[model samples]
Target: MNALVPLPVLLPLCATGLSLAFGTRLKQFQRFISVAVLTAVLGLSVALMIAADMNGPLSVHLGDFAPPLGITLVADRLSGLMLTVSSAVTLCVLVYSLGQGMADRDEETPVAVFHPAYLILVAGVSCTFLAGDLVNLYVGFEIMLVASFVLLTLGGTGPRIRAGSTYVIISLFSSMLFLTAIAMTYAATGTANFAQLAGRLAELPLGVQTLIQGMLLTVFAIKAAVFPLAAWLPDSYPTAPAPVTAVFAGLLTKVGVYCMLRTETLLFPGNRLGDLLMAAALASMVVGILGAVAQTDLKRLLSFTLISHIGYMVFGIGLATREAYGGAIVYVVHHITVQTTLFLVAGLIERRGGTTELTRLGGIAKAAPVLAVLFFVPAMNLAGIPPLSGFIGKLGLMRAGVADGSVWAWILVIGSTATSLLTLYVMAKVWNLAFWRAAPPGQAADGTVLESDDDSDDDTDEGPDRMPGTGDEGVRPRHEPAGRAVAATLHGHAVTTTTRLPRLMTWATAATVALGLAYTVFAGPLTAYTDRSAAELIARVPYVEAVLGR
Candidate 1:
């Protein structure tokens, strides 16, 4: 049972090795193995959560070495909860990828690259959550860095390579800053052990403590895509495969947020960066959403909103109250599932209409009501509509801010409300243009109609459930192009529907959406868990004691 803490990290790494050794021949086996590994991890995560909540922090020292000497993996209430949610999210994304036939033999992306890299990404995320020291956290980040870079540039396509380059440069820059911060932390405290730092850091001069805090937070802020540093994300994420984009949007940035939350609560408890965090939170909310409102591409818009909602989590951290932290925790959990589903749905929208551009897409509701419904539920939840998890999370933060009753808190209260309204506007804009409005001329009028080559930024064509408008019975050639031949062939004999959005992909997306709804259905229990987790994280004593065995 104590071993479950490290299994999440180990399972994925082991899977990565096996997938690589299989060398693409056992594609089906690799797929099933990956799924089974993640399922086990999820079950173990749930068990860890139960044990952590009951037994306090559970620590497993590597090679029987103690903290500050050997590496340690700790599963406290907060880490365990994060592990469970992230595992479930990653598992769904893996299934979604399989549904897309990504693992099939493809010239562009070798099976060797995709499956193993994906499993490595999972291990990296798990490593970050369970890390017990600063150096271990850095290692986790590096694992993620390597895996994500490969995943981002998989096809060597133009936009993907461009996005991948920018992602690499920025990630390298952040890694350097993080390394520098770790050096300073070790130089100052003589230890990288998180438990030991809690006491040692408190005794440092206020100026030194503040400097270290600033440096560490800066690195994490960049990683989290928290405004100013967030510019790379909107472009970088939208260029990848749909499943890749979905997992990136959902998990990677939140790891950064998770780090920030931990450092603020544990190491630098009263060191005073609250005001700065509050200012950053407000700017992120306003700036990110405004950017979203101006976006034409569906993926890009969701990327900007991802930045906007991050402000809510930062808001809670800045307030540093138990209720506020609780609210932020709930919000983080809500956003991960919601944001991932939105991206996955964006993939489906493109597959259905052959484009995610608002200008090109229309009549989705009339043609594929199922896809429309999939998009609608999450869109409203993201907009903070009443009775959803998003609304519940926002209400929690607003109440916390109101209770704090400071000038900044009041400003944040108003700001949060405004951000929520703007989020609604953005979601409504997507719905209006992509689903409600008619398709523009020279474009696909209905989901079944053929999309022009211009519709895809990458020149990829997707099969919709319906066919081109010229057919007598709503049928058209599966791979028809927008050329003289296609023009000449219009109004010919009816063709069979060629739907490319696979059943596994749709079912995977639906499962994730259901998980998002699960949050709302079990809101009370989830809220209670967050509340307790927040309080325990703030306490910090149990963590230190568990590590030191005192």
Candidate 2:
């Protein structure tokens, strides 16, 4: 079992290589293999979490060589928790893609590459969380970026290609900055391993330590999409395939936030940059929500909301107390599950209704009732509705802010609450346009009707194949019942219409909703694990001892 510690990272890397070797000839096998590998990794992550919770940190050194010489995979409570969540989310996304026929041979070449590239992305995320050293973490980031670049440009559509170019450039620039930071840290501290860096960092003068901290934070902030550096996120995330967008939404930004938490609490104790972080956090919250409110596209709105919520995590980091850090840890776990679910649900809407543009979509509640419920639950949770995981996370941060009694913290509390309200507004905008409004005249049963030649033959079109609105001009529209009634009416109205969920898509949505509920039910234990993880991170003593024994 101990030997299996590196399987999560290795399995994906191996799969990537095999997929490349086989090319598109064995796409089905690639999908099956990827799913099996991820499933096994998910199981391992759960086992690791249980074992680490019962024991202490778990470590497996490569080639039986000790740390400082060979690579090591360490699974403390935090790393284990993140690995579990990330793996599960990736698995759900894979299921969703299979449902969308994205993994099928009929898909375009770039889209066909998703299975292999997504596996590589998962490996990178797993490595990032499990890595025991700074250089390893940087390697993980680079691998993830390369995989993401391919996934983002799947289909090679004009919009996707344009957005992807910007994404690639920004990601490459940030990676270079990260490499520079790692190099500088190694020079200053004479060690690249995190545990050793902690000890070495403590020995340095406060000024020098602050400089290193600044460099590291700048690099991670670009990854995390923090304010001023966050412009790229809103533009890039909305253009990808829904399944890819879901995984990116749930895992990518959190990876950056995870790095920040580690650096602030573990590498730089008694850090004085809290105030600067506070300012940045506030800006992110305000600016992100504002952008969300102005968006008409469902994906873009959710993208903006993502940036807004990141501020709360950073707010916790700024407080720099055990309670604050603990809250941040739990919040990170909560946000990952919720954010990914929301994005996946968005994908479902796009698939069922044929368009993600709110202005063009309506009455999805009538067509996909189950999807409506799925999207609604997470939407409310993200708006911080009481009793849900999102509300609990925000409440924890607010309570910590109150207890700390810092003026900036108090402002963050108020700002986060306001952002929540605005987030609700943005979500409501999507809900109203997608679920509440009536389908326009001569439009397909699902709000969108083909008016142009370009839209007529679109694969997403589901209505009668007759010429546009011409057939509808002679016939008067009949009043249809609302909600479930509409589904029954649609059935009676168009017996020949195809409107069933694909088996894989159904499973994917179920899995995502189940994960959200699981987080809510298991919140107590999860939070407890995160608390222990936060405590260990803040102290850094246990980690240092483990890596460089006494």
Candidate 3:
């Protein structure tokens, strides 16, 4: 089983090479390889999860070389769980993208390079989860960075280019900080291995330890989009193609949070910066949701909510108790699936409504009852509706907070409740405007304006403005009057657009929605698992002794 530790990282990477070699020449084969690889990875991840739980942490030194000089990967409960969830989510996204490609005739993701880049992204995510040292973790991030840039700019459209540039710059800055921190760690302790550092870092002076901790936390915070560092995300994410956006929103920030969880428990115990973490959590929850409340576009609104919910996880970490950590773990898993499902639903909404603007969308419930159900279920779950995993996770965290009985914990408890309510308000607003309201008289079911009844060539020069970060920077007024535009275009000329939802895309999204509900069905065992995972993380000895073979 220990020998299997590196396969999750290696499999996708090996498949990536094959994917690229096949390239545009073999599209079907490329799709097959991508799906098959991720599916295998997901299965392996589940196996690893069970094995790690039953047998303690699993570690394998690459090429039979010991840790200080060779690459090492460890799959403990945390990593195994993360690996499983991420693999499942990425696999679903890949299927969705394939359906999208077929539906759009490959125009949306025009390049065949998408498969290779996506596989690379999967490998990178797996690598981070299993990384045994700071340097290896840094490598994982870089791998993701390269692949993400390609995916973000897939179409090379203006908005995508601009958004991709911003994403790349922020990622680069964070990477540099991460690398610098790694160097500093190696300089301070002569080894970059996590298990070795756990013992050695304890011997350092209090100030040095604090400084290093601050550096690492800052790097991860930026990656995790915590409070002040999160401003780039809303602008960066909404511009990409829907599938790209879905996977990214689900996985990337959580990787950062996972790092924070691991280091906080194993390397920097006692929660030296717990107060600061709590403050960030408060600001992230309040500020991020307020941003969500102000958005009129569905995707941007979801992006802001993503930042806000991240605070819940951060709050759990700041509490630094077993229950809090467990709650955080559960929330992380819930958010990854729920958030991804919402974005995919957003794609379906866009497909049916022709745009994501709340002002223009109406009567989706009447037009496509299925799409409305897809959107509503995940939207409500996101708002922490009872009996859903979202509520279960938040309730646990709040309980942990109250149990702590600290003033800050109490404040975060209030903040968490408030955030949940605001999230509900935002989702309800979307529901009211995008689904319940009646469609305009001249508009088609898909939001396109139809021909005027009267034969008037007169144009009203009225239309919706383009969303920021979605290209078309300058607003182009509609040449037709309110009831006269056709195909929902910026210009007077009409262009053909697909009105029917793709079956494959819809079914893929339904699969994700089902996965989210599965959490609710098995909430008992899931929370139990997270609780045990949290305990293992806090103990720290299991990981250290397993890695060092002591």
Best-matching candidate per lDDT: 3
Which portions of model 3 miss their true places by more than 4 Å? 107-109, 441-497
Compared with the true structure, what per-residue lDDT tens digits does model 2 show for residues 434-541?
887764343334343222211222445343432143333422222221111011110111111225655677678778878777767887876777778878877777
TM-score computed on alpha carbons, candidate 3: 0.92
Per-residue lDDT over 221-303 for candidate 1, one digit per residue giving the tens place of the 0 to 100 score: 99999987899999798878778889999999999999999989989997299989999999999999999999988888999
True-structure RMSD for candidate 1: 5.3
| Displacement of the residue 253 alpha carbon in candidate 2, Å | 0.6
Consecutive 10-residue window with the lowest summed lDDT within model 1? 487-496
In the order shown, the candidates' Cα RMSDs to the true structure are 5.3, 5.7, 6.0
Candidate 2 lDDT: 0.77
Q: Give the range where candidate 3 is weakest over 10 consecutive residues by summed lDDT.
A: 484-493
